[model samples]
Target: SPPTPPAPSEPEPPAPPAPAEPAEQGQPFAPSPAGSAADLGDAPSQFPNAVPPTQDFDDDPQGFEQPAPSRKSGLRARPVIALALVLALLAGLVGGVVGFVFANRVFTNNGVNPSVSLGSPPPPGSSARPADSVAGIAAKVLPTVVSLDVAGPSQSDTGSGFIIRSDGYILTNNHVIEAAASQGSITVGFNDGSKATATLVGRDPAYDLAVVKVDKKDLPTLALGNSDDIVVGDSVLAVGSPLGLTGTVTTGIVSALNRPVTTGDSSTQDTSFINAIQTDAAINPGNSGGPLVNSAGAAIGINSAIATLSQGSSGSGSIGVGFAIPINQARRTAEEIIQTGKSTKPVIGVTLDIRYTGPGAKIADNAINGAAPVTSGGAADKAGIKAGDIVLSVNGRTVNTADELIVAIRSYKPGDTVTLKVQRGGSTQDIKVTLASESTTK
Candidate 1:
């Protein structure tokens, strides 16, 4: 006969936590830790780009009423108790490390090291490094960062911006004015508490950059720095009006550079943009157009987006995960926009398959061939490129995807010629096409 079925054991329920004491009315929420959410009766002026503090109730431990022990029970309680102790120890260690990292990344305001305790300094500070005195730098750079408010048709949006040219040229995220460009109004607010109307000069959605101009003269401007020189662990500062909170400053290190983040809504898979710099600085909703400056108070990147679980996500704001566009790219695009009233993106007149990964941008079709438009006897029609054509390479470099193709093509100017190797069905052929300026209406 089979062994007698073991007696049914009741399921173990989670231990209840100790009840928190009700706070006295009218008391302000204290900043406990980097991630703690203190109810100050209102949302933080800045997005609480911090983590919620872990509630350890051991100090007020309530006796857990464990299930009555049975002498005849097959299993002993010692093993379960030992396991709980081990798990608790592991959790404490992990939590401590996480808190330390978060404090270092998101809570260090005005360059005061959140990690250093009891007024202890790290070491003798260098002249060029950001010491515990970020107030001075903030004062110098705050005048350069501006708050951008846009009024769109369906909705209104706000973002941060920085003055780049003394003549009143401002730089901001292109998405801030995308709707406004279609139809709306744009304005800028300065750190000195002055608001002024602004005019949209030009915008480039491909790079998510926009240029705006104000009538004022002699505006303070931020010095542009080379983002290529940045390295992980380099101290940096983020200045912006997060969540409509104007002139907020946070400090952190350059988490990473040359980071790629997909931009654009998820619905349209056909179009997207990438390439960004990752920083642990606290960046939030209204921080989009703000400046990501280096220790020397120079603009290196433009704070654009934070990686979140979803859009309009609630709870702890910045998790030390933020991205920005390189200042070099923004500066070049802004100059072109200001001079020509638009960004002249260089384009190779070929339809490309961005998903192809073998060797080059596989040509699926050519929208423009020869000279005439698809309706007008276009040059593409005369060039003999048809549907089902795969572009193997451009010039000499292999184009594994459409993004690579775009990058290569953008490097060339309009009227310049480039050679493309194509795989027509099973056969390969070389074709030369003249690059075109994106500003062309056709």
Candidate 2:
């Protein structure tokens, strides 16, 4: 369903969910004359979305407050009566409790303790370390980042990419260069104003990853970090040319993990499922293929898509919902592509029932579209995964949809062992399935 077509004509990755807001005419995420960062580059490689909300969109609506349950989460709590209470208790040998209570009430007002001197305090603004902020990480990674200008025969687009190997090997979204892979020119522009022509080495549409190479051997490259180790709430910096703004930097936190995100419309969409790392980072047009680095300046994800309300003439902007392909998946795909002219995907050996509206991914009882419900002697078939079985999870990761099941399986490399939670015959069981290589399975 994916990665097999390395041709230039492969359809673009799923278009980010554009806001339903009616603009003038909805357009794909390409460098437009209306947005910022026009002069930086011409090829924009990112997604489209709506303007971000001024307030926290995910903030839970405050319910009606209950009496007597006030908390000063936003205030600084100063313990001013502690010393007085302790001193009173020590002074009184027997009625110390009575004396301490009297002192506490007199010194405290509405739980607002007076600011008491607690030895010498650090100077104002002494706690913040400049090196620990997003700017610090950006400074370390921006040099390794780059912008790509692709001039296709039919259309031109601007996108972003980053240095992965000092020998001029670059990593980026396959969608970024898909339109220009065969009939166009791709120019790699560095932060220092130097530009070089880059040629595609290999690409995998299944993972939306590609590797391109320049002539230089001394390009700055970013170190790939372990995506499996990243946690929610981790501070991150997204560096790229959002809307063609070169060297643009945005700060955000990991909003979710293992997010099952599939972009594209019903007509032309990649069959591969992307298990993305969700972030609130403002990824916009031309930010695709950019690096999502952590506090330590390690690249953990590639900014790929942004969720929008709908598409229109106003075009898609950032809605604070962005998805990044995990570095773990990207790294493996890129490496395989660099080594070989193509990449292999992991398959579970079953044709999922996409139309089934059931809770979990349902395997079709009958063959549909020439693909059998279960491949004979394939991984799933070997593990006794039948046609009616409903897959509930993968290695403890709950999967409620066929998209999720596919994404979860793809997260693991072929030849790796994984346990699938399946429902069969009114009972549930954990079946161990060793993933089969897409090439072998097919």
Candidate 3:
């Protein structure tokens, strides 16, 4: 402004040389030392805390920027960290592998093979027992046991039987041949591999017993043992045709004796009998008619029935709860059927004092009240007795309970006469009557 601002210089001092070119793009240019005063129009506005080229680490400003790390130093430090991480990972992997190997070794030492095969059959001749060493008892009893095959119209059944005498007499379950009895066929297979046709002599369904005869006489037979001598827990064996696989042998201990069971005529609304021996030895449909033997292999009872899964499927296999008819009862019935063509159980002439009810049976006065001295068309009816009479004793044995009467009655057989002391309306009288056989035909 002093020398009268020379008329605006040409091109205005080249616009102050457009300020020196900025150091780089987006940077303000530095002041040029040779610039005239007027060329340095107002300096560019200063930015707050902006870094300066001449600033020293000691003290150019209260805060300053730190220099960036050198590329070489950063690269060297990176390798050391990477190596340490790699070593740690490698050590962890080695530890895991060592632990797995040690654990597997412990399991293998305890008979656990992680990679072994199982469930395959043992090689032939490597059985647990010697093949040639037959049970001494089995050898003795096998000859007496026979396989029975009976064919009916609707069913073909197989059972087991045993020769009871040298002269062709055989013992088996009555149901075994019952179907065959109706114009069917019965065959017997002996232990010697010989088979023969057999004739059904007679059968008693009430007792679940039957007698048959084979053409071959003088066959080897087993002697019957007394079933009364048996007790609970006695070791026993079962010989039978299980699943139609003939000559099956199973061993067990006697679970119980005198076990009463209700069996027979599932189709009929009313039919059953009691008295049995229970054993855990397996007995199935085909096992019926087999022999329950002792360790000595003597026939003690006849296998008769099994606790079935259901009534409709009686042909299924056993579940260990099997029943056998006591040999004593069977022996009695078989002998009678063979000789008389029928079997009979003892009975008292007087009507039962009461229908079996409650824990123990008791006498009902009306059971004999207004009734004829004897039942019409019965052994008691023929004895000339009147109804309304109570039975006080039988054969001089006091009969307080119906069970007592049954026990006393079973002591005698049909055609046997017994004296009964009767109490009629507060008075007692003596009467005698002969027992009769129960009709076998329905």
Candidate 1 local lDDT, 77-122, one digit each (tens): 6678889999999999999999988877967657776566686668
Which ranking of candidates, highest TM-score first? 2, 3, 1
Top-down lDDT ranking: 2, 1, 3
- TM for candidate 2 is 0.69
Candidate achieving higher TM-score, 1 or 3: 3
Itemize residue pairs with steric clashes in candidate 3.
368-388, 369-388, 371-387, 372-386, 372-387, 373-385, 373-386, 373-387, 374-385
lDDT of 3 by residue, 1-442 (tens): 4677667655643444355544443334443333333133433346434344443333425333344234566667889999999999999999999988977875676778676677899777733433223366666777899999999888878899999988898999877888887678899998888999999888877667889999887899987988888998987778878777777888777898655565667575223353678999888778889899887678889998888678776566778899888887788888888888877765444555456443222334444556533456777667756655566677887766555555555545577899878765667778797887664421
For candidate 2, lDDT tens digit of each residue in 1-442? 5668666886889988665443233343322222234222333334334333243322335422222222343232445466678777777855777778866865775665566557887677744447767766777899999999989989888889999999999999878888787778899999999999999897777777888899998778899999999999999889999888999999999999999877644365444468999999899999999999999999999998888885564658888999999999999888888777678888879998889876889998889989899999999999898997899889998878888888898888999989988898899999999999963110
RMSD (CA, Å), candidate 1 to true, equals 34.0
Candidate 2 RMSD computed on C-alpha atoms after optimal superposition onto the true structure: 46.6
RMSD of each: 34.0, 46.6, 11.9
lDDT of 2 at 327: 97
Q: Candidate 2 — which residues are off by over 4 angstroms?
A: 1-129, 264-269, 311-315, 439-442
